[model samples]
Target: MQTSSTLTPPAIRHDEWALSDVHGQYSDANSHADLYRFLMRWIDVSTHLNIGYSRFGQRHLTNANFTRLIDRIARPMLELYDDSVHRHDRRLLDIGSGRGGAAIHAHQSYGLEVLGIDITPYNVERANANARRRGVWPAVSFAEGDAQDLPIPEESRALVWSIESPAHFPDKKKFLHEVYRVLKPGGVFAFSDLLAVPTRVRQWPEFYKEFLRVWDVPYLETMETYSEALWELGFDLRKTEIVTKNNIDIYTGYARRYLTYFRIPGFYKWYTGRVRRRWGANLDNVREHLRHSYNALSRGTIDYGLFWAIKR
Candidate 1:
C-alpha cells in the first residue's frame, strides 16, 4: 500500500532506539557480521549482498545483498553523471549513513573526502572505528547529528548519498530541503530506499502498521511523491525508477536463508513476536497483519522503488 497517506503516529518517548540496536534485531534473522563489515567498507548495500540472488519468494540478502542492491540501483545515476570525476578533491556527505560503509568505500576506493552523519551514537562510534581500521580516519569521519538539521556548512558538499534512510526522517520534505540547502550547485544527492507503494490496501492496515512498528518510521513515500518534493526543492529530476521485482532472486534468496539458516517457520512471526516484543505489546493483530504483508509481497502486491536526483 502507498506510504504517503498511511500516516503512522509520530515517534514518542521510548520509541527512540540506537541504530545498532535496530541492526542487532534485524541481524538476528541473518547471522552475517561479515555483511556488516562489508557494508561499512562500501557504504552501499551492494557491498554487502548480491541483489541478483534470491531464494523462495523473498529477496535473500546477505550483507553482500546490500552491496548488490546498491550497485544495481546506482548504475543509472552513475551512468548519467559520474560525479566522482569532479569529486575526487571535493567533500561528500552521507546522510543517515549507517555504520559508514559507503563512506569508507568512497574514501578508500575513489579517494574522495567523505563525512557520515547519523543520530545513533553506536553507528557513529562503529563507523569511526571502522574508518580508523581502514586507515581513512582523517579522510572519512562519522558525526552525530539529526538528518533534518545537519551540522554541515552550506554549499560545502559535492555529493550527498543515503541508502534506505530518508524514510526514517519524520518530515521527508525537511530532510530533502536540508540536503538541498547544504549541497553546492550541480552537486548530486543520490539515495535508494523503501518507498511507499503507489496504492493503499485497506485490508492491509495491520501490515502497514507493523511495517511502521518494525522500523519505527512515522511515514513512507512513493517515489513519485518524493520526486515532486525534490523538484519543488530545486533538484533536477535526472532519473527515477522502481527496482521492479523483475529480479526477485534477491528476495527469494533471503527467504530461503530465513527458512534454512534460522529454521524460522515463518519470518513474520519471528520478527514481530520475537524482535518487536522488546518494544512492548505482543499484538497478535499486528503479527497476523505483517504475515499478510509478507504474503502480499510474496504474491506481488507491493514493490520497491529506487530514486536518483541532482541539484541544478
Candidate 2:
C-alpha cells in the first residue's frame, strides 16, 4: 500500500465565476439536478453513483450489498499494480467522478491517493463535502474539469478510471488521448460504460432511437471499436469483459422499484406532476427511454463493457 507521504497533493483549479455558471446550468438540467441525486440516494443511501451490480445472482440487493459489489469491480484494477515496486506509487485520477463514491472507495479499500474530476461543479462540491464528512478529506479530493481536457499534468497518474461515464462524453477519442497523456508509462486505465453492438444498433427499433435521443447519447462504440481506439492511442489492451447481464438485471430491478414506489398515494402524483411541470413532454420521453434502454439491453442491442489497459 502507498503511504500518503509519497503522494503529491492534488492540484485543484478554482474559477469561482465559471463554477457559478456551471452550477446554474447543472441545476437547470433536470437530469443533473439535486432532486435526481435525492432519488438516487433514496434507492441506495450508500456510497455509489452506479446502477447496482447483480453478479451476486440476485436481481436486487440491499443498498450496502450493491455498493460493496460496485467496489468489488474496482478492486481488480488496484490489484493489477500491487507489486512491491509500484506499491508506493498508487495515485489515481477518476474522470467524471460523481459524488466521489468510487474515489472514496478506492482510497479506503486500497489506500490509493485519488483525485476525482467532473464537469459539474455542483457534483464536485458535493463530492468534496462527502470526502470531508467521511474523514477521507485530503486522501480523496474532487474538482471540476472536463474529461476531454483533463486538468492534470502529463504522466502524473498511476491509474485513471471512470465508471459509466464514457457514453456521456461527446468526444470519446479526445478523452482517450487525454487519458493516455495523463497516465504514467505502465499505468492502468480502467473503465466501465454502455456500449452499442454495431450489428444490433442498425437493427434497433424506432423506440430505441428515441431512447438514445432522450438520453443525450448520440451513439456508442462497440467493445471492439473501443479496444482498437485504445490500441491506436498506444495503450496495451489488458482486459475487456461484457457485463450486460448485470446491467439488464439492474434496470429491471429499478423498474420494479419505481413501480412499487409510485404505488404510494401522494408520492406518485407529486413526483410525476412536478416532473411534468418542469420538463413537460420530455418527462414522458425520459421515462419511456428508460424502459426502452432496459429492453435494448435484453435484446443485445446495447451492452455494458468493462475494460482495462496499460499505457505502454
Candidate 3:
C-alpha cells in the first residue's frame, strides 16, 4: 500500500482520481492483477475484454456472432496442428485464457481438448462456469495460475497459446521463458501480444503512460525482443506478424461514442454511483484511455504482434 504522503489528490481529476485513475494502474509494486481486482471488477469479460477483429470487414458483432472474431486469434496459430501425428487426440494449453470463450471455440472447431490458465480467480471461476454452460466443462477446463510461473509441468503440452494478454505481465522475459519451459519437444507455441517500439515510446511518454494506466499494463517488450528471446530459447520461429491498424482502430469508434456519452451533463454523477455499487473505477475516463492507446498504435509508438514458433 502506498503511504498517504505519496498519494495524488482525491479531487475531481480524471487523470488523478475523479475521472482519470492515473495512480496505481501499474508499477513495480502494483501489478495488472491488482488493477483487475480493484479497477476492472465491473467489466464483463465476454463482451468487453477481448479486442474485436474487424479484418474481414465485419463490425459491431454481438453475442454469438462475435465468436468468429474470437476464433481468429486462435485459428492462425492452431493451423499448425497436424492430425496425422495425433490422429485421435489433440490437447492444447491456453495461457491467460480469459473467460473460456476461445478455449471452448478451440474444442468445438479443432477438436482440441484445452486447459486454460488465468491469474485471476474470478476469471477462472467464470471460465469454468462458462465451460459448463457451453457443455464443454471436462473437455475445456480452466484453472487459476500465473503466467510467469505456470502451474503446468515441463514437457507436457503439445500446443500452447495466449491471446492479447501478455502486455500486462510485468516480466515479459520471464513469461516467455516459462512458455518455453512448458512445451514438449516439437510442440508449437503461439501467442498474440501488444508490443512497444522503444524509440517511439520515448518520443511521447505521456500517451504511453495513459495507455498503461488505463489498461493496467506494467510494461511492454518489442517484436524484436520477443523474437530474439524465442530464438535464444532454441525455438524455431515459424511466423511473426504485426498489424497494428486492425488491432486498435476497432475501439476508436467506441471511444468516440463514449466520449460523447461522458460529455453529457450528469453522466459522471450517475456513473459514480453505479461504480461505487458495482466495484468499478475509470469508466468515466475510458474514452481518454482508449484514445491514447489508439493514438500510440496509430502513430507507430506501439505494435500488435502475432507469433508462431515450434520447439525443436
In the range 1-312, model 2's lDDT, one tens digit per residue, is: 534322221111111223343344344454423334344434543245566566656645456545554565676776676742455787888998877888887888778889999997777888898999999989899998999999999988888899877766767889999999998888888988877765565566554464454445545666776877899999988888887666555675566566567668788668777766654423343455456555555566677788888888
- Cα RMSD, each candidate: 7.5, 9.7, 8.9
Which digits, one per residue and each the tens of the lDDT, describe model 1 over residues 93-179? 878876677777766655568888977666787788888987888689999888899898888777788777776677778889998
Q: lDDT tens string, model 3, 151-217? A: 9899878888888788767777888888889887778888888777666776767777667665766
Q: How do the predictions measure up, each by TM-score? A: 0.69, 0.78, 0.77
Q: Name the best candidate (by TM-score).
A: 2
lDDT of 3: 0.67
Worst 10 residues of 1 by lDDT: 46-55
Comparing 1 and 3 by TM-score, which wins? 3
Candidate 2 structure lDDT: 0.68
Task: List where candidate 2 sits over 4 angstroms from the true fold.
Answer: 1-28, 31-38, 45-47, 59-61, 256-286
User: What is the Cα-based lDDT of residue 247 in candidate 3?
Assistant: 49
Better of 1 and 2 by lDDT: 2
Model 3 misplaced regions, further than 4 Å: 1-44, 61-66, 83-88, 264-288, 291-298
Better of 1 and 2 by TM-score: 2
Q: Global lDDT of each model?
A: 0.60, 0.68, 0.67
